[model samples]
Target chain A: MTIVSTADLLAILPELLVMAGGCLVLVLDPLTAKDRKDWLAYFSLAVLGAAFVVGYWFMGALTGSPRPAFSGLYVLDAYGAFWKLLLILVSGLVILLAKAHLKLEEIDLPEFYAFILLSLSGMMVMVSGTDLLVIYLGLELMSLSLYVMAGFKRYAPRSLEAAAKYFILGSFSSGILLYGISLLFGRTGSTTLAGIRDGIAGLPPGDPILLMAMGLLVVGFGFKVAAVPFHMWTPDVYEGSPTSVTAYMAVASKAASFAAFLRVFLEALGGIKESWRMLLVAVCIATMVLGNVVAIVQTNIKRMLAYSSIAHAGYALIGLVVADAAGTASVMLYLAIYAFMNLGAFAVVTMLRRGGLEGDEIDDFTGLARRNKWAALVMLLFMFSLAGIPPTAGFIAKFYIFMAAVGANMTGLAVIAVVFAAISAYFYLRVVMVMYMKEPGETAGTPGYDVRVVASPAAIAVLLVAALGVLILGVFPDPLIQAAQSAILPLK
Target chain B: MVPIFFAYFALVSIVAGLLTVSLRNPVHCGIALLALLGHVAGLFVLLHAEFVAVVQIIIYAGAILILYLFVLMLLNLKTEERYFHRRHAWYITGVGALTVELLMVLLASRFSGAKGPATVAAVEEIGNSTAIGILMFSDYLLPFEIVGVFLLGAIVGAIVLAKTPSPADLSGDER
Candidate 1:
């Protein structure tokens, strides 16, 4: 029997900080009057900032070595550190965005920030966990917080609908994931990834129970990352939820899920790659095609971004299919790049609202360049990056993934992904065109009345940060590439 | 003797599961779900997992089922004119496909085989709860703590979703 020591607690410092901070915010929320909720946002931001500091410090302390603490139920490594930093950064940015949006919408509830911080805590735990049970608990914690956050605007019927839809589907997918874990446990009599790996090391390929477990796990993960056939909830949830919450879900949740998915597959089930590779290939193809094709028809900006997000998930899967060190590194880099571009796009969407009208429709963005050139240009940069256009981070992300795929001799899948990516250009470019080329629609109260588009300074700051991150990543991606490479060194 | 009890519990659980789904009135369905949970607990007892059986009874049959009944009563749901909608055909088809897939996998696996990685030989000797407690405190400590955070999140989520908006909120006054 291995004894757990103080090292276990030290290894999980980031998660502990976030959880404690979240509880602090939750407790402080009710004590303060509902009107002065910005303090809560500031408090949550400070907490996330502390978590980031601790994460970086711990990452530096760990240096190059991977340590499995608490008897290998949790791991402290560059991989977890890399994603934790990203999650912490994303959560902080989302809080800033939420602060501005919630102020605008008159939502004074402090629980919003608390939920987001708790969800971030959950994601941190997930990316760091080595055991299936720990991962599942973290996932549930994240999902539950998100379900509430999605319906943060309880007065809005659409928000309520989004919450209900997300809750039911999310619970079902979690059930499927748990069932898969149970099946694997039954086969291996162990729930830790390392144990499962050791148990299945000598097994022949294509064991039916193993195959079923893999399929179920894939289905479960497919739902989490918004892959095809399992992505039916994405658009509705994205469209109906508050824009700030939508951005948080799109960026942070996907990163955490993919992080966990990579750890489980590339580490636990890497030996059974032959049995699962074909299923993933099919999923990748279908996700790219369906997500791209369906995105073109969306007039709602949030729904379009949701579909594009799904397509991006497929693009990320290409690297995982390659199943090499470079592939894992590229996927990490892609997610890092994606978190910026996707959140930036949603930030712009959140900015579009003013004077009690939602700017969700594509038509609302018509002639945005004429109204607000800076917003349009920022939106343009985000759209270009999302479409994987050259001189943008998205292009570099795609290039690395495709390069990894080609190196693995999966040229056919790479080509298919590229073709779908080109197809996606149509919809992403359509947003740019509407913002730049088309004329602004007439204001509602009067003919030819100009509506003032207002964005708080905080939201603009988020957009700027995201846009700058994209351009910097596009031009000088070597540092991030190196970071990503080291992050997945364990996979090699 | 165990096989006879197992068969009885399994059959009853299956029938109760079907009834839980088929019954039009939600209260009756809730009762069916209770029966199903009880039979599942019985099956757990037959497996010699006394701890699990007790948990199944206390958590599922006692608390969760009662909560379901309270929710059904609170919602004041009426009897539906039609049990299944036209669009529900896809639901049926989907469930059918899943069942078939599961059945094929189970058959192909040939379930009677050497048990893999029997890691818990001492479980019975130490007793189920005690062994679990030991593992929970040691190897499973991280997950156990994570479960605490998850429950905390759930509690916060429940309050956020269910609480009536305060008067300050209804007034829409900016801070």
Candidate 2:
């Protein structure tokens, strides 16, 4: 007989707004005129704007106090709020990119916006989820939505193949995660993250169930993060999925998953640091090495980005390896910066993929600097950012993570990560070399390459993100660093 | 008090699950899955989950199995048609099933409790649908709505995917 209070509703207003917006878009999709498919874009943009407004409202009250907003399911604190705010911002940018990208692909999908919101809703839940069960549920919600988004282009056989593979692999990972949860639940008799912390503290050393559950859970998360040995699905999936979906998956989903990983490992299981930290370091090292090396050989831009994502997961895992507030903060900063660089790159690539054809191969962009200066420059920015070169967000993100690793006295791992980053730079620089050094080849189907029509919206988003991300995080990094530090405050 | 119902239900359900996976014929698999669904419903009944049993029968047996059968009839599938089927589908399915058994062994060692998991509050109250529904509406409300949202997404995806006019071919036909 409990009455639903406005305050309670307001606590989850962002999630509610996202869900409502998604449904409203879905409902309004078919009822609209055909040329007005772009209205779906406007509707989604409006919804994200409203979500940002709500996030702003929440931020006004954020004195860094952690409140169990929904009877302890969600902890409304700086950390969760920070991730949520970024998620809201990223959701709109990706959606904005998709509107144009889908039109360029000649596939008018109003539902695409709705799906993005759904996935965004899932990520928000995951980042804010204080309970392990809620975490699993959010993870599934995100995974399922993403599975479809990957295969949205049903006409393409490869896309279908990619979807099937992703589905099977993702479901297997979910099973492993759930099994891990069951093991943890059996050992602790509690599913709450806070309760798990207490239960682990009470348990004896060399606890079998705790160790096993941790192992299984790490395996599960390792798949989502696309680290080594568990990353068999990444290249195929990234190559198979549409570029827009790939960008969202690579940046948004990975960020949210890492956010949850940070919360689960650092917050709940903080006491057993020595045990889990070793495994994470090993995984981090492996991911960094493999992602960079394999990416060098990739011909497809999507596959290369996929491998880069894996490497960045390695960078992000640096945050986990350190297991400190600074490390956590660096992760938040890295993720925000990454969304802009990665999504912007993909958005431009999607627009360039004209004539209902797939994107141009690496060769098609030969002398892109001559063909489309803006896109070429944007690509150069993305490449440099990803390569951890000077004056870009990517550099700052990598520096912060590496510095955090050094702070934790893991200079050896940090040094290894630096070497891999250097190796990764070779491939990224090669893309730039293709654009600037080489001549534009006899690449056919380059008709829809005007890019002025396409580049403005995507470029505006990408330039804003890539430029600001690189500059602000690099030049005026203190505020961002502080925010990143504060964002993890809830966990501690 | 009613170990017979529990035992019978568990035994039949397990066997049906095996049959469902093991059977080569699609229709037979549907029927086997149905059998499994029924036994699970019986277990629900024994566990004081009358509503769950009814819902289980309705959803699993009625809806899901029917869909399976319909798909089978529609596709006219001769066999499982799994990749690497011609080489060793039966053999692989056998090995795959054995591997699943091995996994069950591992899972039991890790997750299962002795005798019954009657310790949980949800278990002690009842396995009925009402308790689950109450939990869904009261505690797990967000997840419930999210699932509904997921279903909506799925439907939209299905429509998009199933809507077929080859753009390449259609371009020529477009007035």
Candidate 3:
């Protein structure tokens, strides 16, 4: 047996702390007094907040940090560190947003915080899974928690139905993924990507087993990314989950999964590029075009956002299909920008909501401009960003992605993505028009609109999200874009 | 070492797996899933992976499957006394059977390729733990951590959604 080193744990310290934090919270929640259980919220936030700092430290440790700590089970690399930090940031922001979202809905469980922490920990591990088994475990950890969260509003049958449907589809996809893993493990005799690469290298080109692995694994990942044909569960699940949790799923979970997807395909199966490039290209085009076109018709704002997310996934995937250094950077830039735009938009929706039940339909947003001009403006910014409109981060993100695709001689796919982006703009702009042009109305209320205009928790979260959308990296995209290039696999 | 053992385990796995899906009573299915889990553990042990075998029992059988049972009970799945569904259930089972069989066949063909490296390359490592541990720490260290955050998000979400609103908050009497 090899001796485990301290540096190895340091590489995984953030993950450990979060994992321990989750278990600790789980253990402590039952003992805490009823109202004080909310303190677990702060405890969770503090843990993730601290781990975010640790993730930054890991960024420093990733460079030239190839020392095998657990022999070879885990590796410290810029690739993994990048996702770690992104997920940590997303988790913290989501926690803050959930404070009001959940409170407004009057739903609470100390168990909720612990589960989210565990899932995010899973996502971080997924980003750096040099081994297939590790990836499966990470995927499951994330999937299980997500399944529970999707239906946490158990009293609401829609949430329950969404949870059930997601579980059935997700478990089926997982079976396919596991089958692929087992096949890959059999072919390589080793589950590690390095070992698998060596195995594939020894085999003849276009081996049947390798093809099968690709088919199954692609189907598996396709589901997670909401790619075409495999995207049936996404719209339902995303719409059913609470707006805040949906925001987490749309941005952070998607980003981390794609990060892992990019690495596994690039590093482990680069040899089989020719076979998959076209396959993924087809999936990308289908996802983008279908996602956008269908989203145009959704009346429910959450469902509309869900379809739009699928479309954005297609755009981000164009970056991966290009398979170049610039492509990785494009994906990263898009994800960071996407985080703000999508989450901000959801935050606005959450803010507009009143009473216990969420305000979900598009009609709810009518006269939003009159009700709250700042929120309307913020929503406009998010919509513009989402639509790839000029002067917003979305436009810059698309420019880079298309540029990367063109660089890879994938001009056709890039052009298609651009056209879809234009189509998406219509729906996004439609929301703005409704908000600005429509009239506000109310029958009567206890906290009447005439007197009760106090800012709620949801409003506070929207402010943060809107600020992130308008300012964070939109005005200063270079730094975030540059980081994407360094954090991902260099395609030289 | 006995062929009968392999045959018996395979039969048990197939039967239990079927019962897990076919049984209308979720409690019955849950117990059947335990049987399937036991068979899977035996299969793992047969493959000489003690660690995986142990985990199959403890994690899969002891924890996850048990969670399913508890949830089923909590939901009072037996409320109707007789579970009923559409006749189309056969269609679903048929597809599942075809897929699982296809997988088994596919796996059969793959045994030879991975045999050499797995046997010799892994002999130096004790109980497959060291090899598994090394791959996890050195290669998968990154994904290992993010999963924690995923769980955290889930817990927080569940808690916030499931928490009961105090009357003050419900009545709009408190901020």
TM-score of chain B of each: 0.80, 0.69, 0.73
Q: What are the DockQ scores of the candidates, in order?
A: 0.52, 0.25, 0.24
Query: Which candidate number would show the highest DockQ if scored against the true structure?
Result: 1
lDDT for model 1, on a 0 to 1 scale? 0.87
TM-score per prediction, in order, is 0.95, 0.88, 0.84
Candidate order (DockQ): 1, 2, 3
Off by over 4 Å in 3: A24-40, A61-68, A354-356, A442-454, A457-462, A490-492, B1-111, B116-175
Clashing pairs in 2: A392-A470, A393-A470
What's the true lDDT of residue B12 in model 2?
92
What is the Cα-based lDDT of residue A404 in candidate 1?
97
lDDT tens digits, residues A218-238, model 1? 989899999998999999999
Which candidate would rank higher by lDDT, 1 or 3? 1
In terms of lDDT, which candidate is strongest? 1
User: Which structure among the candidates has the greatest TM-score?
Assistant: 1
Cα lDDT tens digits for candidate 3, A1-492: 344567767767887888888889988988999878768878998999889888787787666444444556666787788778878877877777777777765556667787778888788778876777777778888887878878766666677778888889999999999998888877777877777878888877777788789878889999998889899988889888877778888888898889878877887777788888888999999999899999999988999999999999999999888887788878888887888788888887776654434667676777778877877888888898889887888888888999999998988888898899999988999898887887765654422123112256645765566566556566678777767777777442
Model 2: DockQ score: 0.25
